[model samples]
Target: MHLDPFELHRPTSVDEAVRLAGELAGRFDFLAGGTDLLPNYKMHINLKPHLVALDRVSELAGHSLSRLGAMERLSRLEQDPAFVAAYPGLADALADLATPLVRASGTVGGNLLLETRCFFFNQSYFWRASLGFCLKADGDRCHVVPQKERCYATFSGDLAPPLLTLGATVEVAGPGGRRKVPLEKLYDTEGDGIRRLRLAPGELVVAVDLPDGAAGQRARYKKLRVRPSFDFPELGVAVAGRWNSAQVDELKVAVGGVETYPRRFDELTEALVGGPLSDAKVASLAEEITRRLRPVHNTFLAPDYRRRMIGIYVRRAILEAREGQGG
Candidate 1:
């Protein structure tokens, strides 16, 4: 069936884009790679009257590395010098999204600001229609986990987990003014309306900043999905920490697919601070953090299984980050 008809606008600068978007507010949408947006558009999701494309704005495309020289080195004996020196955990996080072709076209801004997702929520209009809409899609009540007052759609993207661990910040330009905020603040715990991105009317994400400390910190992302590749995460964890001599000095963790927003396990973070990067402590911390997670049945897997896997993947991520610390 044909999707709804809409107007499209291409503005050359951030100011212009914001003005048009603000002027059109509820009627407009800011387009990135059309990666996730277009599909939802076709499904008659939000029903905006216009598509405000951000393609002409040149600022959102490139990426760069910051210097974090104080951190410990991960490996030595340099083999494939590029591979040996490269930040695979960081690079791989970006590379692992959808596919190379999609990556080439996909904007980092779009990926960071993706809408929350779930197995029951992301279907085509016809598919959703057949089952009746769940809380996230069309209907008021959640079909995936009945009696739930709100939606439990999982936020399942790869970039966010690592970015959050790396202490990435998002910059936005809008009618209100330009501002940058920690990516962590962009999300809230609850899932309805699902997006935690706090961009205002006419605002568009300009660039993402990876802090200098984040560049040097040892970080890794572990994603559990049904397929080996390309699928959204069933459970994902990103952990970044630095070792000061022999003790874990600082740690940042971000988890996806188990909640409405990518979440940080503060209790575990507090426990790791000033503690040794020992195997036992990390495992115990993971176990303790898993107990705090509240996974729901919106995903393909059972909630109990997803909840248990969060701890498993969390421990794996911690070990990977520790491994990168270079004993």
Candidate 2:
């Protein structure tokens, strides 16, 4: 196998890194853990040029929980509990990504910025060469199911699904300046070239601002894959908001490993609002969900099977959230 040649850049500071990234513009690729990028290079899937490693940028690594600890004061209020409760689900989601060894080296900024995946596309150049290139690779068509105009790669990151459910905002530093945007909009609908991530040239994701969920809001991350662990999701669901209350308030639903971005079925969520949370209601909502999702045959499982499981997982997620909320 032939390895692609690429230049590597390591800046000592975030400011320097951002500047370097800005100067390099679209020509450079950002390196985090190299778990995904290295394999792509080895497979000849990408001919990388000017790799800017973010490892030297200390600001992107390490996180603080002191803010959540500060919320302990709110426990004093008898009528309303403190916001410390919101951290558990977020912490749990972060803790659940990959294994401990990977976590030590992996950064939150990298995980959130990871590229979308497709079983048919994320292969060695040899594999794609044999099958011919799909839309995501060098090829012009989708191999999973031909006659498609765009790539059908699934966004396989586990953190993104749950983070969107929590209403997290991403902070990125670029040449123009620093800005924050809803993490949900970071992905684009067009899957052929990379999904719509608003990452500007010379921009680096710094930290993500996660809005604390309400005291009653409960969230869960459920992923379906061939293996029980270590494998990327074939279908992932993240459900958040106050499902435990008698009246449903704001709800956030995001699904991954099935589409270009984490998909939020707002139309379906609206159908369930103000209705009793029941098995019957769940069943009815499942139909709406099925209508909204269009999964392709790109993962380990069949597209039809994946589509069917979408409803199953959505129903199960709601039930689980309700149970957690004491509904």
Among all candidates shown, the one with the greatest TM-score: 1
Taking all chains together, the TM-score of candidate 2 against the true structure is: 0.84
Worst 10 residues of 1 by lDDT: 68-77
- lDDT over C-alpha atoms for residue 282 of model 1: 79
Candidate 2 — which residues are off by over 4 angstroms? 1-5, 65-96, 190-196, 212-216, 243-245, 270-275, 325-327
lDDT of 2: 0.67
Residue lDDT tens for model 2, 1-327: 656678889987778887787778778888877766777778777565888887766666544432111011111211122323554344434445566556555555656666667777777777788887776667778776576576667777777787677777777788888887887777776545444476666777777775654334677667787875467788888788674355666666778878777777776777667756778877777667767878877778888998898889878877777677421
Instruction: Score residue 222 of candidate 2 by CA lDDT.
Output: 71
Span of 10 residues, lowest total lDDT, candidate 2: 69-78
Local error of candidate 2 at residue 94 (angstroms): 4.3
- Roughly what TM-score does model 1 have, to 2 decimal places? 0.87
Report residue 327 deviation for candidate 2 (angstroms). Answer: 12
Clashing residue pairs in all predictions, respectively, total: 0, 4
Write candidate 1's Cα lDDT for 1-327 as tens digits: 356888999987778888898789788788777778887877777667898887776654444454211111112111224432344455556545566556555666677778888766677777887887776656777776676567677777777787777777777788889888887877765445444556665677777776766655677777777776577788888887787766888887778878877877665687769968788887888887788778877778788888888888888877876766411
Residue 247, candidate 2: C-alpha displacement in angstroms: 3.2
In candidate 2 the C-alpha lDDT for residue 315 amounts to 81
